[model samples]
Target chain A: MIFAVMVALLVTMVLALVRAFMGPGLYNRILAINTFGTKTVLFVAVAGFLFGRPEFLDIGILYALVNFVATVAVLRLTHLQDPWSGTEGGEAG
Target chain B: MSLLDHDPTGVASAQNRRRKSTVRLLRTAPLPAVFWLLLSGRYEPLTLALGTLSVAAVCWLTWRAGLAHQSLRLAFVLRLPRYFLWLSGQVLVSAYGVARKVWSPRLVLRPVVESTPAADLPELSQVVYANSITLTPGTLSLDVDEDAIKVHSLEQAGVEELRQGRMLSRARRTEARG
Candidate 1:
């Protein structure tokens, strides 16, 4: 069961990567990357359970924190570039 | 005499503020200590001493940064578990929905960027509300302002649900004073 979940998570990460690569806008790419990060965190946790090494949860938690901070930092950088870019939410292709 | 030399009221108020901050620091210490212990799970003398040092440094830095000034009511803290339970349910439901959409043969997305009023919520409550939105799949809090929050949703229904204010009310109830 956990193996199935991990496979699903891997598929989701691949889809996110595809979206990031084919993004029509920066926000879309950022969103995709964030989703990928979330999936990675889940995958790490599930893998820990699968392997019977609960210590992997600590890395999972750290990844979650890093993912959140990285997302916020990237968003802040984009905001600096153009204040109205985030709020408009229009495709930029 | 110069204004800096002998202003009794200034000196007294400064001392009082310092005392209050000290109290706040003391109140803030235990939480980080507990968090460190839970994460580290080691009781060796060296590990324990290092944990204590790190926790103290964090507490003092947060105190210096004025982050400790915003104290949550005990009622709010007590209600957090209930809020988290409800939030987890929402997350699961929405995650399922998003997953179905993702796996569907044809893409079904109605992306929206909408702002919802949040002026009535306290600051901490607003943080909770925004984070809850982000935690749920298909919805992300783009920006939180003094009176409103900008949310991006993969589907119009997600934004509609937020507009209905059920989540907002629940978040507010958590912080409501007894």
Candidate 2:
């Protein structure tokens, strides 16, 4: 069961990567990367449990914090540069 | 020649600020201390001493940066476990919904962007609401401004649910005073 969940998470991560590459605008890329990061955190935690090494959860927690901060930081920096330019990529909505 | 040197009120207010920061530092210290204990899982004297030193350093630095003031109120902290339980349920339901849509053969997306009123919520509550929206699947918080939050939802129903304000009310409740 755990292995199946891991496989599912891996598939989601691949999809997120595809989105990241194909996404039209900077925000789409950022959103995809952020989603990828979240899946990675979940993958790490599940993998830790599968391998019987619970210490991996700490890394998962750290990754989650980093992912959130990185998303916000990138958003802030881009908004400062061109706040209104990304509306053309509204398809990601 | 300096502002503090000439104005007694300025000196008093500066002193008051210092005192308030100290109180906040004391209140925030236990959080890091507990985190260290949980993460280290070590009770030896040397480890305990090091943990104390590190926690103190972290608390002092955060206090200096004026970040300690951002700590949640006791009422909010006490209610967090219940809030998280409810949020996890929402996450599970939405994740399943989004996953179903993703796996369907023909993509059925009715994306909409709408602004929801958030003027009544406190700053912290607004942040909680926005983060919760992002955490749940099918909806993303595009921007949060003084009086509103712009949300992007994969389906019209998601925006309608958000507009109904169940999550907003819960977010506000979490920060409510005892």
CA lDDT of each candidate?
Answer: 0.85, 0.85
Rate residue B164 of model 1 by lDDT: 92
Determine which window of 10 residues in candidate 1 chain A has minimal summed lDDT: A84-93
Candidate 2 segments exceeding 4 Å error: A23-25, A69-93, B1-10
- Runs with alpha carbons beyond 4 Å of true place in candidate 1: A24-26, A75-93, B1-9, B154-156
CAPRI class assigned to model 1: incorrect
TM-score of each: 0.80, 0.80
Error of 1 at A83 (Å): 10
lDDT of 2 at B64: 61
lDDT of 2 by residue, A1-93 (tens): 999999999998999999999989998999899999999999999999999999999999999999998998888797876554543332221
What is candidate 1's lDDT per residue for B39-104, written digit by digit as tens?
887899999999989988998787665566655568889999999999999999999999999889
lDDT of candidate 1 over A1-93, digit per residue (tens): 998998899888998999999998998999899999999999989999999998999999999999999998898787877544442322111
